[model samples]
Target chain A: EDQVTQSPEALRLQEGESSSLNCSYTVSGLRGLFWYRQDPGKGPEFLFTLYSAGEEKEKERLKATITKKESFLHITAPKPEDSATYLCAVQKNTGFQKLVFGTGTRLLVSP
Target chain B: EAGVVQSPRYKIIEKKQPVAFWCNPISGHNTLYWYRQNLGQGPELLIRYENEEAVDDSQLPKDRFSAERLKGVDSTLKIQPAELGDSAVYLCASSFGRGSYEQYFGPGTRLTVT
Candidate 1:
């Protein structure tokens, strides 16, 4: 069975604080790992996609790194606007378009 | 280019009632998806469409849920005799192609069953 688990269900960080959210997965064959940011009353916005172990991607103050069994979303110098629920998902190599998502990590960055 | 669009941002209804949600995927996108998201949880895939054909719907509850992508451009998800547990946000997303493509999501429709 393929499953995704995200750690630290909720985190409260002061402005400019740095932290990392974790996503552990168990899949038949790893195809792709995705990161998204969702705000209240809105949909999730696409962040990054990591395909292989040791792969990393960055956008603005956010960076995402992946390993064989897990992934990490590192927030550097986060701002109030960076507060949102971060979701991590994985797609299997079976050519199916469906994505298995984690429970997500709620992040609140206060000024 | 406009992102995925969904109608009726919020809806409230009684149990056993029928309701429908609409989605217009991004122009030229060949793949569309419908997902249900409960509060405090991530979105779960209900159905996925490739062009006008439904390629994956194993997670959809066929007894009460049905979906259609008429022209492969827009789609609709309907729930007949909705239940109290069906209250959740219905999200629509689209991707240009199949494997490994990034998906863009809509604002989502929040459904509340009383």
Candidate 2:
């Protein structure tokens, strides 16, 4: 079965603190890995998509990197505005484009 | 361009009642998806539509859940005789095409069943 697991269910960081969230997956074949940010009472906002190992993408203070077994979302100098639940999902190469998501990591950046 | 739009931001109802959520995908997007997100969990895909055809609905509970994407644009997801376990946020997403990797999401409709 394909499964995604995110580590550190919750993380509280001070403003400007840098950290990384981990998402490990076990799947038969991986087509893509996605990262999203979700605020309270809101749907997830697309962040990045990593297609292969050693792939990296960035937007503002966020950077995402992927490997064969896991992916990481690294936040640099995070602000309170960046606080939200970070979700990681994987798309399999099984013809269909269904995404299997992880439980997500709740990130809180306090000033 | 406007993002995916969902109506009725919140709904509270007693168990066994019927409920429906609406979604309008981004303009020109040919792929639409409906997802259910429980508290403390990630969104799970319930159904997916390509144009006006439902190509994927393996996860949808057909016994009580139904969805339609008429005219290949806006869509609706209906739950009949809703159960307490059905209380969750219904999120709608859209991608440019079938092979697109990035999907834009809507605000979602939060449902609470007592």
Candidate 3:
């Protein structure tokens, strides 16, 4: 069965602190791995899409790196505004567009 | 352009009652999706539509849940005889076309069953 697991269910970081969230996935055939940031009462916002192992993408203070079995979202000098639930999802290579998602990691960057 | 739109940001209903949620995807998007998100969990796909046809609905509980996307521009999801476990946020998303990697989402409708 295809599954996605996100670790560190909740994290509290002080402003300017750096940390990483983990997403481990098991799929029949890896097609794409995606990261999203969701604020309270809002739908998730797209962050990055890594299609292959050893691929990495960055935006401002956020960087995402992927491996064969997992992905890491690294936050560098995160600010309070960066606080939100980070979601991880994976798409299989079976020609279906449905995404299997993890429970997500709740991040709180305190000022 | 405008992002996906959904109506009735929040709703409270009693069990066994019928309720419906609506969604308007981004203009020109041919693929639309509906997902249910529980507290502390990520959104789960309930159905996927390609134009006016439903291509994936295996996860939807057909016994009580039904969805429709006529004209392929907007969609509606209805639940008959709601149950307590049905309380969750219903999110709608759309992509430019099939196989598109990026999807834009709406604010979602939060349903609370009492």
Candidate 4:
């Protein structure tokens, strides 16, 4: 069965602290990996999509990278506003919208 | 363009009561999806539609849950006699079938069943 696991279920950091969240997966084949940021009571906001290993994307203070067995969402100099649960999902080439998701990592940045 | 839209941001009800949620995807998006998210968990796909057709519903609980996407645009999800375990956020998302890897999400409907 396809599976996704994220480490550091919860992380607390002071403002300006940098950290990285990990998402490891085991699937039959890799098509794409997605990253999202979800605030409390709101749906997830799209962050990054990594199609293959060694690929990276950035937005503001967040950087996402993907590899064969895992993906990482790295936050640089994060602020309190950057705090939220980060989600990772994997979609295969089977031509379906089904995405296997990891539980997610809750991040809290305090000033 | 407007993003995905969902109605009833929050709903609180007792067990064995019927509840419904609505969604409107971005114009021109051919794919629509419904997901269930528990607190602290990632959203899980409950159903998916491809131009008014339900392409995936393997995870949906057919015993009490049903969904429809009329005209391939707006959609609705219904739960009959909702159970306490049904308390979760219902999220609606849409993506262009033109191979767009990104899916836009709406503010979810948070359901609390007592």
Candidate 4 wrong stretches, greater than 4 Å: none
User: How high is the CA lDDT of each candidate model?
Assistant: 0.94, 0.96, 0.96, 0.92
Q: Tens digit of lDDT per residue, candidate 1, span B1-114?
A: 899999989999999999999999999899999999999999999999999999999999999999999978999999999999999999999998876369899999999999
Tens-digit lDDT track of model 4 for B28-111: 999999999988788899998889899889999999999998899999999998999999999999999846778899998999
lDDT of 3 at A45: 94
Q: Which pairs clash inside model 4?
A: none
Q: Interface RMSD, all models, one decimal each?
A: 0.7, 0.5, 0.6, 0.9
Q: Write the per-residue lDDT of candidate 1 for residues A61-103, one digit (tens) a residue.
A: 9999999999999999999999999999998888575789999
Better of 1 and 4 by TM-score: 1
Q: How do the predictions measure up, each by TM-score? A: 0.98, 0.98, 0.99, 0.97
On residues A71-108, what C-alpha lDDT tens digit does candidate 2 reach at each position?
A: 99999999999999999999998867799999999999
In candidate 1, position B50 carries an lDDT of: 94
Ranking by DockQ: 2, 3, 1, 4
- Give the lowest summed-lDDT range of ten residues in model 2 chain A: A91-100
For model 3, the docking class works out as high
Error of 1 at A47 (Å): 0.1
- Candidate 2 CAPRI-style tier: high
Q: What is the lDDT of candidate 2?
A: 0.96
